[model samples]
Target: MVNKLPLSGETVIFTSTKKSEEPYELVRQLGGNPVSYPLIRTEERVSVNDDERMMQTRNYDWLIFTSQSAVAAFHHKLKRFKMDVQDYELRVAAVGEKTAHALERIGFRVDFIPDVFSADVFVRQFNPEGESLRALFIKGNLAGTLISTELSLSVDEWTVYETLPEVSSAARIVELVKDTTSVTVLFASPSAVTVFTEHVAPKIGWAGYTIGAIGHITKRALHRMGAPVHVMPETYTLPELVQTLAGSKGRN
Candidate 1:
């Protein structure tokens, strides 16, 4: 007996910064057709102040990375400045598994990852006392302010990238979602959710479609934008979200 895949004959629309091959391939592996249209784009920003601060990396006690983009941007900046990351004597803190993996890929020894995979969770769990414990936060310009504001350590933040809305043609997005009874829209970030809501929500009504949020932040953004979310995995990862959506076929 040939067992059918959970997401067989379904179409999933991915709205994020870029069309990643891994997620698309994963969706195909799960027997689903993946349509990728980035509604947000990430532009790496050169922070002169941060570049100067990078020279003094040894002074910081901890280096925090919230997203994979941040890790990539920070590493790119380091290479551009002719800095050797391996020489920096700093403990690294990554927000989630993906972010940690990104750091690990670049030869960084991640010292901490919170139980929960959110900035709020990371900040609350990483309770650093005193201003003497200086931590550098490498993040995007659109990042939430909660982590830096909440962390007890003296924080030095560097905006290494900016996320801007990259709305595609309404016709293109509409065509991608055409005639799909259960088009699962995947949102990985708050910016992606915001852009989708602003551009695509009006054309596609809430009926006959399912929204899948990758994490708490994305889910909260959907709620704030008045978009319905049908699938949100306990684990904030692409694989888990895809699995949750596969299992959420019959559920409202």
Candidate 2:
């Protein structure tokens, strides 16, 4: 007699900018058939003044990172410019643990992380001093202005990457979601949620499937589109989302 895995026989769908291996492997480990139906793609932005922008970080007191992609793009620019992060006298604040880990991997010492991993929560909790600190926020093009608007600091934003919808994947998404009885679709970003609602939901009509969102923003996006969100973890991370789904046995 073998014990049944938590996500046994469930078809888990990942709809994000990129298909990450960690969460896919986790879903597979729990006996789910994981599918990568990316609804969005990210591209790093390049500029002629990349060197000047990279050098500008030295003047900021804090380097704020909201996503792992931003960290990756930042690191890539640093490497291209042959600049070492350690040489800059800047404190770093990450919106979540994953972003912090990504920064740490690239030799940055993360000084702050919000209790909750959302931009609104981050704005409320970060920089208690209100001492007119200057921060450079490295982010994707579609990121919200909440952080820049709410933070009582001299905040400047640099668009390192842009998130674009993978409109070509619409047919594949519809095909994979055809059998919805054992399917669990997970969305990571609001941008992906927007893409799905616009392109895929029109075909499938937003029913007969289990839906999971990574953060409040994504959940809100799904709700605004009249899609029912079945599962949302307390923590806004992929591992937590997978664990939450597994613990629930992939059910509503």
Per-model CA lDDT versus the true structure: 0.81, 0.89
lDDT per residue (tens digit) for residues 118-203 in model 2: 99999999864647789999999999999889988889999999898899888887987795568889999989988998899999
lDDT of 1 by residue, 1-252 (tens): 333466788898877755347777877887899887778878788755766767776689999998898888888877888877678787999998989999998889999999878998898899755557988888899888887899888888878888888866445677767766657888889887777777777887655677899888888888888878889999988878888887775343
Q: Give the TM-score of candidate 2.
A: 0.95
How does each model score on TM-score? Answer: 0.92, 0.95
Best model number under TM-score: 2
Clashes of 1: 0
Candidate 1's displacement at residue 95, Å, is 0.7
